[model samples]
Target: MAQRLLLRRFVSVTLRGSSGPVGSRSSARLPRLSSLSWHGTGPPSHHRAGPTAARGFCVSHASGGIFNVQDQADFTDRVINNEKPVLVDFHATWCAPCRVLGPRLEKMVAKQQGKIVMAKVDIDDHTDLALEYKVTVVPTVIAVKDGDIVDRFVGVKSEDDLEVFIKKLI
Candidate 1:
């Protein structure tokens, strides 16, 4: 119950644009908190938060195809040496475009059903790998097969364009 109240207060202050600190008891006019339903306790079932609300941050690599490249050695072992063609997604957590394209790439890669895999490399974490690939911008995807770059692209591509790109690799 206490958690729900705190969440409500936080949301109220945030949505209301209160100038005071988040915990401050300001008298700003807060918008309706009806949209937020915690633990299936508030409003109708339709208005309740989804399962993701409780899980917090989770990156599921159970697909066996989508994985993160930890470092240069990990990259060489998993991406460069893998049996399947790997979509080396050069990205960073701070990159706005990378965030947008990451999920799209994951979705398209998932559709392949293990035919191909995605190797996500955070440019900030692995600077050497980024430099080796000559990645100056975020969200650069390289299709690599047998340790050779087959094709590559920079920035976000439309769903249709992504699909076409992935299909061409296979």
Candidate 2:
């Protein structure tokens, strides 16, 4: 009876281990979100990967919104040549503050979809662009008009502040 009990305990432990950590079911599989690649040439299309029933990219902004630029070459065309005002967000994946500020920027983009364009450049992925913009910190947001940088915020700023900054351009 003792041997049987020991075997049952071992099986329970093994089953628990095979199932992921607590709270996750063994049969549960995480859905994969689409991978976005921004090469600085322009914002790539939002790609979603998952089960056919899964929702695809759900950017809340208006159409032609949410640009992800990857390289300096792409940045020039997208930001400099664009007719609308541009807000470039220099960020990195590992930055804690950047993560916090990201959603805020998204909301800002949705708020200013027609008046301004939003682009994100990952500093870790594009070091040269970060250096050119003098981005020493993550979550640096720069406002560009007619290819000239008119104003910039080094860290997270309130939406009101961003509004005032953009208002100056108008």
Candidate 2 segments exceeding 4 Å error: 1-62
Kindly list the per-residue Cα lDDT of model 1 for residues 92-153, writing each as its tens digit. 66578988999999999999989999999876557788889999888899999988999999
Q: Pick the candidate with the highest lDDT.
A: 1
Q: Which ranges of candidate 1 are over 4 A from the true structure?
A: 1-60
TM-score of candidate 2 to 2 decimals = 0.61
Evaluate residue 75 in candidate 1 and report its C-alpha lDDT on the 0 to 100 scale: 92
Candidate 1, pairs of clashing residues: none
The lDDT for every candidate, in the order shown, is: 0.73, 0.63
RMSD per model, one decimal: 10.4, 13.4
